[model samples]
Target: MTTHFWLNETRPARQAGAPENRVYVRQYGNGRAILLAVHGFGRSGARMERLGLQLGDQFTTLAPDLPYHGKTEWYDDRYTPREFSRILQQLLDRYPDRPVFLMGHSLGGRYLSSCLAGLEHPDLRDLVLVAPDGAGGRYTNWIDTLPSMLVRPLARISERPRSILRLSGWLSKRGIINRYSAEYLKSNLNDRPFRRRIAGTLRSVLKFPPRAEAFERALQRHAMVCTVFVGDRDPLLHHDRLQSIYGPLPSVALHHYSGSHWLPERLLGEYYRNSLLTTVP
Candidate 1:
């Protein structure tokens, strides 16, 4: 049997082995405020590069790759809140008085919220969410249910998802899973790198249960304003569903726009690509 312990500031001083995390953060912009952006599932920190540019140079955007994505490395089985805070703590430490903003797209919202559940930071001024996931709507995954014994094996299968895509399709056809789940799985499964992303983070992400309450609490505790953007035609997280989760919260404002699930990619991608092309000599 093995036991592990975490040493915090309040605890008695003792020698303990701390795991080091190599987080790859892509910095963009050179603004006064700090905007810490998180990308969606299966994507690296580069996914938010365009977003930083779109927001102009008023924010120092720090986009970091989570486990199983980009250049970041994570060996621990669990992606704890302490780890999340430690990764972003560098920026917070450097600019103690700077106002901070958080932006997340798709699954990035869930990942960010989960990691924030264990943190306390009043410096967080606002949260900008684009088509956020895990807000208790149509953004449910069908492959989440399985016996405890099969969880490990199922995670392995996701590494090479070609074999199980058919099963996902079958479930979608029968109305067992939503349209977004089927489309999302089919589109990314064929790509080996995306599959690796899914496999590396699936087990840890599945452990992240719904955290709407925790998110609301964080916003209230920090007195941070939240802006939620939802696509009217988005199959995954539509406007109505998002309102249901954020409507009652005093700090949250829900806004709807005309688009689909890939709204961010459609807009941000185009702008960033053009920006890059024009800047090239």
Candidate 2:
């Protein structure tokens, strides 16, 4: 069955000097409960529309295209958690009186984690992370080692030597790297503007990596409920790693599923019903 919802196609004007983020929001229902859904890297809010629709009975879901993806425009070449946090704050301001329950996947989850660590928002009620990236792991450790100052310059350099990106694709074809990894590398290399945006994003994240201790502190400070879902075979993050990183936190609960980086639609629907619905009331 086809569902009807409102789509705001206009690009909203952002403050001067800040990144121009034209948020394309897909709204479902007008329920009393508020929900803000964020999508992963390389994905748009349109991806989260299904999950939002599934939970329409319980919430008014606001899924917006994040900066640099989908219909959103990012005029500033630099992207950092602080800048992204400001964008989030603007979105939150739209619903000043309501507490928002946040659900994010992959990169989206990382953004939420960063916000919880550094920003203070009294209206943020709870959090749900699906295969989140900012949590401690080998990937995060590698990110921690990089110098943020060098990232943008390196991105520029890589653009000139297009061979580097082509070589990455060749390596993927030769089975040196997994197909998923290879495609991701090639996509960035082919798109110069996106590559620069990605560089800025990485630079910001590396400059201010999320601290597990800080996440715990924030959760305690806000008395927020957090639920984490991890796929057992997720190429990006494994369930075991999630356990090691977030297991000790009293406010966070972890659930494992038999899937990969992307959970089955049935499982995702059930998650919304079981986790979000139960938490709201």
lDDT of each: 0.65, 0.66
Residues 45-162 of candidate 2: C-alpha lDDT, one tens digit per residue = 7786666667667667877776667777656544666666666666676777776788878878877887876555666777888888767333344445546565545445554537
- Each candidate structure's TM-score, on Cα atoms with residue i matched to residue i, is 0.75, 0.78
Q: Stretches of candidate 1 above 4 Å error?
A: 1-20, 76-78, 136-140, 143-152, 183-187, 238-240, 263-281
Clashes of 2: 0
Q: What lDDT score is found at residue 153 in candidate 2? A: 58
Candidate 1 lDDT over residue span 1-281, tens digit each? 11112212222223466444466777777766677788877677787666666654556777877776777755454464555666656545666777677777877776666665554454666677788776743544443454546556656887667665876777778886777777888888888767766665656666655556777887777776677777778766645656777788777787777887663645643533443344323
Q: After superposition, how far is residue 205 of candidate 2 from its true place, in Å?
A: 2.9
Query: How displaced is residue 131 in candidate 1, in Å?
Result: 1.0
Q: Which stretches of candidate 2 lie over 4 Å from their true place?
A: 1-21, 117-123, 136-141, 161-163, 166-179, 238-240, 263-265, 275-281
Q: What lDDT would candidate 2 get against the real structure?
A: 0.66
Clash number for candidate 1 = 0
By TM-score, how accurate is candidate 1? Answer: 0.75
